[model samples]
Target: MKRILVSFAVLTSLAGVALADTHGAIAYSPSTSAIGWSYAHANRGDAETVARRNCDSSANDCRIAIWFRNGCGAVAVGHRGGWGSGWGYDGREAQRQAIRSCRKQTGSCRVIRWQCSENE
Candidate 1:
């Protein structure tokens, strides 16, 4: 009964970063409740691969929820089987957005994971 949506902002036009870009991605499987994440990776593809590969060890339906460069990302899960993800320049902002996004279709949701990676 889990519903998940992934944002395709990967390699977007405004994907340029500052001096250094530390890529990160978060993967989750609602069915198995498995979570995997990568931070400070070389590129988006690598970051996503690591996260998905890690989660794949435990989940059959794991999907990349969010990706970000030189920032933070978060995932929120609702008791009613709803999930959402958000990323921002900081952990608090990322978590806030994650909860807000989750509350869109759910009422009882809380953040399960969050991480930040600054440009090096």
Candidate 2:
């Protein structure tokens, strides 16, 4: 009986963790080199607000680059001021997409930021 109860309690705790929302966002300056990113918030609104606020600390024209929930997000930049944002189930996939998007506008694209939600 004790063993069974312990297993049940662990499962219940895992379920509650899985139900929680993990929000993330990235913000960038339109005409500057400023960028800001955030992750693991409770909701999308808070994530975006924090990202934008951080970016705005360095520049006046900051904008949201991307927002994600329960996944990975990436930012890529290239020569000639090209920029891109992507979201995916994993970090590699997200970086690939960001580079792909940036390549459309300019060459020599590379990932500048990448993070996975839930610490994955």
Candidate 3:
């Protein structure tokens, strides 16, 4: 009975850790040509804050593009004055989608950044 209780306690702790929400954020400033991203943060606010700070170092008027919990995000830039971003459960899929989104606005597009939260 004691061994069973110890096993249950360990499993419960593991479950709690697994359930904790992990966050990711991206920041960008089109005018200043700056982009920053962070993943696997403990909270949304921390993720955004860190991303914005990284952007602020290189650009002005930086803003959060997106935030995701237990997911992935990506940014893409096009050849002809276009940019796009997307989020999804898979990092590669998010990058592909972001490129696709940028291609919608311009002819050719390439991925700028791809990041995934730990949970994803």
Candidate 4:
């Protein structure tokens, strides 16, 4: 019974850790035609602020593409007018999805940024 109580306590602690919030953000700049990304922030605002700052450093007209909590985000641009973004639990999957989304809109697409929040 004592061992069971100890195990329960450990599990509860682990659960709390897993529940902690983590954030990721992606921003795009039209002036420089660049994308900036930030991840593993403790809050959504921090992640978005960092990403926007990074983008603004290189160019003007910066805008956030996405913000994710406990997940991943990605952005893609196409040869013509197609642009896409995706968010998911897996970083690679998010990137792939972003590219895929862009391709659906246009024939050519490439990934610009991919970021993931730490799961804990």
Candidate with maximal lDDT = 2
Q: Tell me the tens digit of each residue's lDDT in model 4 across 1-120.
A: 999999999999999988999998999874566777788899999999988888857477789988899899888888886778888888888888889888988888888888888732
* Model 4 worst lDDT run, 10 consecutive residues: 28-37
lDDT of 3 by residue, 1-120 (tens): 999999999999999998988899888786765888888899999999988988867576788877778988888877776888888888988898888888888888888777887734
- For this target, which candidate reaches the highest TM-score against the unseen true structure? 3
Instruction: Tell me the lDDT of candidate 2.
Output: 0.86
Local error of candidate 3 at residue 57 (angstroms): 3.0
Clashing pairs in 2: none
Q: Residue-pair clashes per candidate, as listed?
A: 0, 0, 0, 0
lDDT of 1 at 120: 27
**After aligning candidate 1 to the native by TM-score, how far in Å is the CA of 60 from where it should be?**
0.7
Stretches of candidate 4 exceeding 4 Å from the true structure: 1-11
Report lDDT per candidate: 0.85, 0.86, 0.83, 0.85
Q: Candidate 2: deviation at residue 74, Å?
A: 0.9
RMSD to truth, every model: 14.0, 2.7, 2.2, 2.7
Worst window of 10 by summed lDDT in candidate 2: 111-120
Estimated TM-score for each candidate: 0.80, 0.83, 0.85, 0.80
Residue-level lDDT tens digits of model 1 in 1-120: 122222334334335543567888899999988999889897999999988997858588999998888899999999999989999999999999999999997888899988776532
